[model samples]
Target: MLDLERRLRGSKQRLLFIALASVCILIVLLNIGVLSDAPGIKSTIIKVPLRGDRPYDTIPFPTSDGSDFEGSYQPEDAHPIAGLMKEADEKWRKYEESRSKTFRETVAKYREKHGRHPPPGFKEWYKFARERNVHNIDDFEQIMDDLRPFWAIDPKVIRKMAAKLQENPDDGIAGIHIRDNKVVNLTNPSWRSETLAGLISRFVKYLPDMDIAVNRLDQSRVVVPFEDLQELLATEQGSRKMKSDARDGFTKNMGHFLNFEEPTGDWDNETNPEWFPYPGRQYMDIAKLACPPESPARNENLTVEDADALYKHQLGGLVTNFNLSTDLCTVGPAIQDQHGFLYSASSMIASKRLVPVFSECKVNVNNDILFPANMYILKDPRYVYDKTYDYEWEDKADTLIWRGVTSGGVQVEDNWQRMHRQRLVMLTNSTLMSDQEVKILTESFEEKGKYENFSHFEPSVFAKKHFDVGFTDAWGCIPGDCPFYKDIWTFKEAVTLSEQFKDKFLVDVDGHSFSGRWRAFLFSKSLGIKATIFREWHDSRLFAWRHFIPLDNRYDDLYSIMTYLIGTGFKTNPADNYANNNNVYVRKHDFEGKMIAMQGRNWAQRVLRDEDIEIYMLRLLLEYGRIIDDNRDEIGYSGDGSELDDFDKKHPMPESPPHLNWNTI
Candidate 1:
């Protein structure tokens, strides 16, 4: 039994040992796997594989909120940060409220002071405040400070006042008092006299019944009678002198004023009913008395037949001197048969003769014949100065000077009237001639006749024809002789007139078109037909060599003519190369294209050129073009370069040919 018990104990001990060894081996394997795979595993031993497929070292632990530790972890909110954020929000809200309150108060205050709502800038309100009393920013600021605590006054009012005061310190004005009585007398003499007279007159005329008083000695007393005071004023030498000299040297000339006397009959008589009579009537009476006696009637001694003969002889002399033809006799019936004058009293004076005889009749006729001649006298010298004269006489004498002989025993003061009459006859004779006669006269005039008074004659007779040939030329009929009348002719009309004489006149010479003096004369006989054509078409020829030829060749001439035209206010379009070259042309991409081209060419040619003027003109063209383009749409025109482009394309750019120098272009 002991042996069997020993065997059982031994078997049990062995089984226990085997079990402990197996456990030890498992622990060792786990330790080796965990410790060997992971680096720096010091404190705790973990299993080789964690939950699911994650490695022990890679899997993160759960945080307190049951989220991933890396993502959920956050630092605690510090007291300083939270406190600062709250403080900022509170400050911002308070600031906004304060600003809004300030703005509202300012607006309200401005409205109250100005009697109307303030403008957005409070400009008027500030001006008013400155004008009242607020003089400087300090004053304004002080007022604002005083009113800041009050709800009634606006802070903005103070601010605006402060700003205005800062801007203008002496803007206010106070009513001034004159303490010294002598100060009034010491005032500007003319102003004081005028003011005093005006005051007295106004009281006399407007407030006749009202008492007039003055604090001369600072005592209030009933006013004296205005009439009595006026009498005293009239008697006072100083007052009378002032009144007499009121017109300066004007009233001193007694030739202009009239004297009047009290009425002899019952003053209120129905027939006369005169207080004194109109000053104008008194003037007429004075004028009648002042006028020199008329000469004794020399024509009265002669019979009507003798008078007719004398008149005919005088007319024949005038006609002969003026070179008037027999055709003028055809209108003889329309003319007057007066003993002295050429035209009848009722005759419609043609413009050709009106200028001359009007002056003659004005000076010659007495009151009996003056009735008809009075219609010819222009009331104002300005009318004669402006209407009757051309631009040539603008700088000449104010009154026209004339020199000539007179007939009909008419004693002339100045020979101006006679000379004026002669001029009229000459002008009339010139206009009334036939085409052939005109040609002959014009030739004769050019050849033998020296220019008498026609200082404004142009090289071409077109100007003469334009001024003369009244009924035949439509341009002559334009009111005021406006230059714009020529613009009324259509391009077609101009083209027709051009074509009519193109073969005869517009002949090409030396590869260039030119209308000589003779051809131009014939064309001008009608109505400036040749001038119109040349001005429109061949006008470009004036600047032809500018584009294709070197500027140096004719630069001086080109520059002079261009400057002249520009100075004279000639209209030039950039597209119209015929009227003007591309000198003033402007382009969008190249604003100073022409100037640049000019400068470049000048530099290439080694010519000293006016860069300033070239650049200035370029800038002017660019600016003008921009202004025109901007307003074109409103002006019922397309802003696109259509018109300019079309014209430009038709006139091709001159190409540089062969080995020619580019400096010319």
Candidate 2:
């Protein structure tokens, strides 16, 4: 009887264990989207997105054959052209008249229909309409004037001037137009418009040119390529000596506004460079504290809405990463060392001088990190597309495409940011990827040449456990010859062989610091899938879905998210079809997705042009000039510096002071 009781007790224990194990398995399955319908859930199994375009559909993805784009703006402020400001003012007046008339008619119609005029701010109801549909007077004149400076003599006028010059090329100083019998035949002329507004606008355009010329001249004076600066940065004593020299005259020359002092901390590995007036950790903590309540760091397992929220916060929170100062140019918090010397880089805020770089937990700065237009499009300007892509929607492959180097991941001892690259490799090699939605071209960590230094990377370790990942050959420089540049370091070569960018979807992930090809992706006219944890100069201007799809940095969510997007008409209709795994059986055309792509392309083409770059650089120079001009007295420079004379000796007015009493003007 006792033996029988023991057997019964053991059987009961075994039954309980089985029940618990089944429950746990069910929970795991649900979390992994085996049964969950929660949006953007990852499927344990991988598959391709539904192809909505027809085989013979002639819907060409709007493209251009790389003509009509122009190069950098040339310096042409030799002479000011006439009537530009007057022309601009007259244009504004006409627009105001037309708009006022239309607004009056609208108000009358609204009163008749609703018994009251439209609420306040009705005229400004559509803010984007003016920027999108109608170019403002200022914008129109700026572009036109820059492209064809009014001072550029007409072809007929040029011929007359040439004829006069030929009569006596060396002796004759004949003016293009008769001016009081005086030749006034100088190569560089003065501004023609007398209006203060016009004069300022015209003067501002040339400041950038002058700034560039001066910088070039200064660069020539340096003995070696950043040699002195490099040595100073490498050692503490050299840095201190350089600081002492700056205090002697150069600091005063720039109108030293703040008192100088030596840094009060050990120059350790954890500290920022001496040029930065404070430690990096201080500002980094401030950024974290200033994170808005809606930041994604507040929660996990986020949805698309959460991602959008994070993007907005990042766009606005850039200011929190710097020290507080009413003066925009203040470099950092002050120290109390009166004997210390002042240097511009030390006195100017780091963010103002350089864009911040993120490699794992550390932050660095790089001023040379401009958009790749200079390196790529400048090399072959004809390659720029007037529209977006070079293929039709139906002809383009539906796969998600990416190609880059395995850079940061291998340097685990130095950089933690490389995990994103590793995660990408794993997704491409997943055994469950029967449809192969993701097509990546990159060297594997085990590759013999480039990534041989990297340690072993198992896809399953970085990705979901059920992926059943497999090994794939490292595609180190297989296709050969980068179409972009000669010295293509990463990817070993351009991975344009598969025509990957021409694919329906493009993935842009961060490299060592930031994604260099993000702007290209923005203008690609493909569904841009951006996955990063860094903020760029264009952050505030970007909008998710309207601009590009924002993917989480963790990258695990990409597979599930892409599945959701392609299956649900790119989220236009989230309920179009429901599936247990990443596969979608139902195929529906995603017209809205195409529209989003077009919008993104249009925005990039409009704002990221060479003309736009010129304008940005010009504005920055103007601001710096203003600061220097404001403190000219303390700087002890007469208006006779050779550099000033080179740029027409046109000194910018003080930006601040004396509240401009009307009578003073």
Candidate 3:
């Protein structure tokens, strides 16, 4: 029996040991899991590879092989005189260069002797001539002589060149025809009226007839009307009287205002103190307080409506009245006065709710006045007014004497005083409350009454909608201060929320103002959403359609009337399609359809036009010049190729067809 009992005890002990081991294992596993998931435990480090490459080198200039100036050569069969002149021009240039040294030396000596300055009266003229490299007086005279003959060249050639350059200047070589005293070699694959105008203005001095044929130097032989050249020049010169006619039309369209006035009595008699006892006297003082001398007695005879009207009129007058003593430039004093006026108006309005004396007086507190003033006072505690000014007495002695007479001053009693008296009477009339009831009713009401939540209360029904969307209504009476100011945020939120809700909400762009910043934020927050922003005041239709089309990703459908041009189909030459200005092809369609087609067509025309080409070339030159001007420090090259180096570094060589290698084909 003793042996069996001992065995049973051993078995029980083994079971207890097993249970202890299991608890230990579970605790260890729990700790390991917790520690592994801890935020502080970092897993591994990462190293990203960096890829570096060298910057690009400047491209070299292209070599010329008559191919560069291919289209510029006059055909052997056409214009025999032009071909002869070209040969003669080459010979003349060589001869002129050989003889130029002596002339240059003589001119330098004369300039040095003259002290390198123009003779006094010629300063302006000298400055103007020097800009065009006319350093010597003789060169200036030559330029003036060139301008004197208007019809020296065929106006046709001048117009054609202008039109061509207006279209695309890259198509041909630009040169001055010395014999004809005209500009030539305008080649544009595209042509536009504005481009033509620019060309005409550039070379208006040489009036060429409008029938010259404009040809592309390449394989494409594109030809266009010279009439475009003539009309463009005429329009540019304003010789067509468009400006004068426009002014006349504007004057005729203007609506005139009629002069009228109401009859009035003599000011002195009407304002006489005897006839009009009050005259300009206001019921409220300039400080917006009740007038001291008239207040208590005036309240007796004035009706509530009359008193309200008088107070409003006086408050408005005080606001509008300019104090000459204060410098108008000082906003500090003006803001102070504004705050004082607002406080007084609020106090009077609050008082009116009690007495009904100022019932009709409506002082509109708008959003701008509320938020800005609240923010100002919050930022600077000193903005609050605590003290009043004493303007009546000269000294303490005078004030004491004045107070002595007013000690028993008549007090203005009203119905508001009676209401307060009745509140106590009602409480007394109720059955006596136990301690628990008093705690529940009185203490609870004091802690959680309507007034306790005044801060969160929407000032009015209309204000609730605006406040929720982020706008204040404290200065509602002021222009640009009402809930309308929130139209921008409202519109943006509507559009954004609509997308998120999937057609549950829609913003009327026409109905509300849209702020760009808010719209940007909304669009950024939503993953697959876009909103159209429309300008409120200027060209609303254009702005709306443009914004909407872009948002819808319809790039091809949108068109700007300002940039519209005629299509390329009407041109006789197929190469004209490539001309910058000449390529606009106007098709028969609705305005909207025409606008869309005009976009790409105009771009093609501009490339083909000659005058457009010249302007574009000049623009490229200007851009290169600006770059050189801005980055003068980085300009560097090796050795004595430095004469033009310094000059070119300071003023980059103009980008031209020769320098640009523009035509790879």
Candidate 4:
């Protein structure tokens, strides 16, 4: 009987050992993301050794909770954002393959694209592209998108319009004059004109003497009506008639680029002056005129209350197609009140008239030519990442950070809360000083396995642990409206750019225009979570989800995106040692987040270098030269491969400025 008892005791000890081993393995798997995290993944069975036949036995385990709230957020396994990395990788691969590697290949591709011989100075531009290692030579389609429309109008008429717009401070347009292989004049005394002249002076030697008008306001200038744009596009298409003898190289233009001639007329810069200072009047009174009759901006009418609901439905819980979401024509006209750029943009000098005007950025509703913003070109210290604070992904705090002013628009009493910057601060600051509960996706309580559930978290505590977001000040609101913003919200002291570099993820939302600090954020090692409706010059070079994370302008997806990256912090769960214990396991995505961060950081260095900008400008100038030339049809580049060898000997590039100081400009 004693021997029998000993045998039973020994068997019990073995079973206990097995049980302890299984628990340890489970913890390891859960922490490593092997057990959960991805959508449609994470197993529900544990293998145990069997006494008979098979070496192991499969023990059934509970899956995620099948509750309503659990299904709403990012669940364990099979989430939409899980596949974004692979998608971005494949897209980048395809984009690289699409671009021409050799100069001859670029020339060959251009003929197929434009159906004509290369433009004048095309050979010199190619050499510059090769020397500078420009990532994008073939994709200057934005220049085409803006310049193509002007092809429908008489070149002389376009030139006249350009002259009238230039040197007009009331029009908020700056004139840049390039002559004798140098920049000679920059009309308008704004710093923008000076900085632009400095940017153009880098390669003015390769460019034909030309007049360029740049819009100085944060708002876009041209808003071509939909019917007019369609007709213009058709005419532009006809202008690119393919030449049978079109081949390699370029031909010098017999006709010279003419000086901008002012048209004889009284110019009215402020035709609609009374509309000023009214929030959302730009979209209602002006921008929607660009949308087609069938488009939602023109067709669908919704009150402010209905707009949010409809916008969310139209935009899914997460953003998959960043480009498609920014289509102003697709969304309801209610965006007029929702977006600051649409509502209270600095557009006192906005025009429905089509002109060859350049801007830093514009929405799909505007037709302004896009150029690289000087804010990026200048690289101010305030916007630059502090190298002293930069850390590796594993070493960095797993938090998302954002800091900015309330400068989206001039906020009034009624509409201050609707501005994107204000809304972002409020949402991120939820529950911090109050009992407000915000929904967060974290491991479930009472669940046997690791599964994310849409759980409620105390705002102050939760946001403090995961997010460092707030405004430095409330700057753009009207006098009466401004004081309350300070009262209701806690204004945190502004943190430097380098301070944000310590975090794993950084949020970048639009200001009055594209964020001046975008280039700096991209330069950092952290994930750049960008949310904007405005389109910039380098949109074609980078892929969303791969290089950076894209958020909807509505900001509904902000929390979900954050959860997918750093994870919801520890919460009370049944799996803990005891009930109500705050020891729930949450998934951290360092590997995934770092993968995207490195991809963006590396690609930014590759394609968005200062040299790359100069290369893009040179190519664009060559195209612009062709567009404005009187002998546009006859002017072409016909250089063979031999010219590339003797490029410098044939046409020497001008020496760049020794130093460019932004503060002085």
Candidate 5:
């Protein structure tokens, strides 16, 4: 009996040992899997701030003329817009879940094929894929979701928002509210889910007159608790920083602001608002709450008058927010204030009280007349002083210089507007200018080899057209009378004309669109002889003789203008003016011309600075905010905060200065 009991006890001990071993092995395996999946969690979370500082403090709202609000305002009860964002959030969540599944599968496949585990995190996958020349490892479009957060205001919704308002219906202005950057509540320990209505309600408390606010709240929300997104955000941030640095370096070295590096960030892939890229970049570049530079930061508040005055400077227009206009008849009209002027960079409703810049077109979407309203006017990367050339009036080369491809339109027999370029190209010898060598840099070219059908004509076809009859058809002057290339030299190179700053005469002509190079030419310290009919953002501010020497749309006066400059009639004193009835306008001599060049440089330096732009943007926001508030009843916005509804009603837009009449030109 004793022997049998001892054997039974030994069997029980063996079974217990086996069970303990199995449990221990299971725990180890689970831990290994978790560690592999979330190797980047800590790094990613640490970079994100839980709460950010509030953008602005409560201040008295101002009217269009930059005065305190005297009109009565009744604050609306809090009606949360969080429900509006439900669909967006749900779609994002589903995508996150599906993305994780596919990502895991990809990682598994990589490991199985290599006979070893790949890098522990998906962020590393980018580098791995690049090393292997694999582009299809991940669905890039899925990563950058197209369904944005802000819903467009439809007629029904507009009525709802308008009905919510209590005061000022008939004369109120209606504009879109786009929260380019999502505001966050950093004080909360964890990201608290909030709605669009909730966010706007909180924002309007600081500026009550605001009619509507639109934006995607995802950036302000908590990140999904998944390894894949955490990895993507981290990777994207790193990649963006690297690319931004590279672009900054290029711009700085070249002494010009242009985004040469193609945007590789996920945001660039999304179909954003018309004014997304420009203001989005501006907001990100300067993350601080924009206000007047001289105002006290915390101790004192900026009065509406004070803020308005700062933007009243010549460059103040640059300070305004993106104007949102929906039609063409209401574009490019200016509203002056104590500080400067206000114009919509985007779409705004047609109102008699406001001015328009570019009238919107519903039928012909590609109307060459419409300015690329979405493009930011400030220098690309960031505004900076260009002291690269010291071209004194006497020392500058006598030749007139211009270089660019025919992008405005194809110079075919039917397209007369495009003929202007063909006329210029005829001057350049045919043997030197080949098919593939010089042609329009279209949307396809801008995308490099990724997209197609961006140009007006193929390179070979374009060359043939220009060489055959397009040039002759466009140039109205006879062979010898044409004066194709005397002192003027036009060529094509993969570079900006800033390289030719040493030339005495810089010819500024209208391209397929607005002349982006005009700003650069203004700073080149050389005499800019221009012939552009395209009205741009700063058209009202430009004085005929002061900013540049004007030439009529046709080149009829081209030879005569050149003769006045290079001939013995060229005088040094601004007082001694040279005249030619054949020329559209009288030319200023060397001394006065130098002063004008200096003035142009000074204006460019003052108005086009980084801080100048920021001030203009903030002031514009305040102005638009007031416009929304004053007309809320008409536009269907409701909700309350009368304490925040301060306005300036005394001084409206100041008496306008004599602006260059575009119609007459």
Candidate 6:
């Protein structure tokens, strides 16, 4: 009950079901005379739903994704973007305030979340964070969620499994070891190896001696089937009995350097025989197994329905529940063709069994543990944002700009048009997607409020006027199909990071994996319009609409979002003209755009800093340490923490001010 409650509390889902269920249970008991002195009482009261059942099968958000609408506005903001902003700001504020402030609270929070004491050396981990001035201490929940099922497997079995994985160089994974407070890099120097070593070195001395296996490839590796994953989790969490020899401290010198004392799993302890590996082909069907039985990605028909739902616009198609929007389980089937990973990841080496792997980023259903990307940590000049070389939102051109090679997944000539980078470029530069219409929020000349009209638009003209999107290179496609790409796409000269900074809106999308350029984009003085299927460590800290605009993976909401910020040029008597003439009424919302741009820039500085990266790594390592310990059930940091101050609790951080009152009147 406590574990379920903790999960629900952390989720955006409601907890009102508990109270409603309880009341209905009481009424039923009374009606049956189980709680009454009288014998024949057949009266009933309030009915309620069971915990197993949910009213809304899909995302609980009421606002439409603008997929089923073809009508005028209700004398109000035609787009739900304004309402989205309000809800986003409110959600972020509540989450920020809900973070545990002090040591006692942090320990209490850990217990509340896991229903167990903090692992041994947790105090040391806390001290390491406090000494380095770490802020968000209680946000290490992902580590637990990743490591929980492993608790069902014996610690010896886990150590042996990791050792075996490390032995298989063909597995495309590297070994990370910690000994006497130093990260031992036992692999050849590479970007991932160096970055992992550098990140761990920041506070490796604080972590216990343990062996870690990290995916060497850029792509995610492990993906347990939903049913199997559920069983693993339930078994792990249900068995709480401690071994007779279990102690309350970590084993001394537990890092075995690839030499496990126990026999290999193939002998006495056989590994899961169901670990199927897809070499290098389409893995969408295989990947879909990770989603729940009900998600759209799990079925062919549901996926088609989801695909059509992209703009099927009811109350105006706008993004809400940014997290849910990024969920790969629900999103993959809808926009699989638009993503490379779905159709063909460059390295499709994968597993359907549980394996601990530290990765840079992953989609929601993927089980890989996330770490800070090397692009952000390395501070490469190619991806860095230098304010001295950049323009402010007000000083820059009022246009959204994007420039990148086509690298989402391995693409081919036939599939080139479906890939995200290619599709985005096509949507802006040509009329491949839309013959002439662009979904937009504009003034309703008919009678009142803002109007959401699928207005006529020229992609080339819109690109020339409001966007600077193009492909710098046509790579990713098969060599045999490479010649056909140039026929379809007109490649432009590649621009530098500073060159892109000239635009007021930066568009970031997924590449072969998660875009590493997001951090750089956020640091700039421009509103970031990002659409991605991957989730990263910074996801919990970043709020869409408040910091950045979140776009759906399908990108059907593209024109609508663009028009909301930079209006259609339908100014002079739009009622009569209907924007049919070349008279583009170019109405701009510079204030709103600049507001979000500055907010994103400011927030990135505080939470996405290098120090914060180190803090997160340290916290993740601490949790990982407990999972691999022989006395995992017994060992824990036992401290009352009576001496901690509650400054944040007493006076919480002030929330961002309310939405600006636009003087439309």
Candidate No. with top TM-score: 6
TM-score of 3: 0.13
Q: Give me the displacement of residue 247 in model 4, in angstroms.
A: 12
Give the Cα-based TM-score of candidate 2 against the true structure. Answer: 0.38
lDDT of 5 by residue, 367-444 (tens): 111211222332342222254654555556655676654433322223322244544454333433433232111112
lDDT (0 to 1) per candidate: 0.21, 0.32, 0.22, 0.66, 0.31, 0.68
How high is the lDDT of residue 95 in model 4? 70
Rank the models by lDDT, top first: 6, 4, 2, 5, 3, 1
Instruction: Point out the worst 10-residue segment of candidate 3 by lDDT.
Output: 398-407
lDDT of 3 at 530: 18
- Cα lDDT tens digits for candidate 2, 439-523: 1111222431121111122222112322222212222121322122222122323445235556777777654445556776677
Q: Which ten residues in a row have the lowest lDDT in candidate 5?
A: 335-344
lDDT of 4 by residue, 425-538 (tens): 777874543555433444545663334534344445446677888888777777834876756777889888888899988899988888877777787778899888888888
List candidate 2 segments past 4 Å from native.
1-205, 208-389, 413-418, 432-494, 568-589, 631-665
List, residue by residue over 168-244, the lDDT tens digit for candidate 1.
11211011011111112111122222332233331121111111111111001112222333343343322111111
What TM-score does prediction 6 earn?
A: 0.80
**lDDT value for candidate 2?**
0.32
Clashes of 6: 19
Candidate 3 residue-wise lDDT at 602? 24
Tens digits of per-residue lDDT, candidate 3, 1-665, equal 99999999999999999999999898677666555757764323222224211000122111111112222222111111222233333532343343211223323433443222111112222223223322122322211111112122232223223222322244232212111223333323223222333443453432321212222121111111223324433443342111111110001111111111322222232121111111112213322221223333223444433433331112111111111111111111122222222112211211110000001011111000000011111222222211122111111010000000000011112211112111111112212111111100011123321111111111122112111121112231223233333322222122222222221111111001122121211121111111221121111111121111121111111111111111112335645332332323322112221212222122222222233223322222221121112121222111122233343244332121211111222
Best by lDDT: 6
Better of 1 and 4 by TM-score: 4
Q: Write the per-residue lDDT of candidate 6 for residues 209-291, one digit (tens) a residue.
A: 77777777878888878998899889877865434343446767664346444533451333432345563366667778888
Misplaced by over 4 Å in model 4 are 1-76, 242-285, 301-316, 332-334, 432-460, 569-586, 638-665
Note the clash tally of each candidate: 3, 3, 72, 20, 50, 19
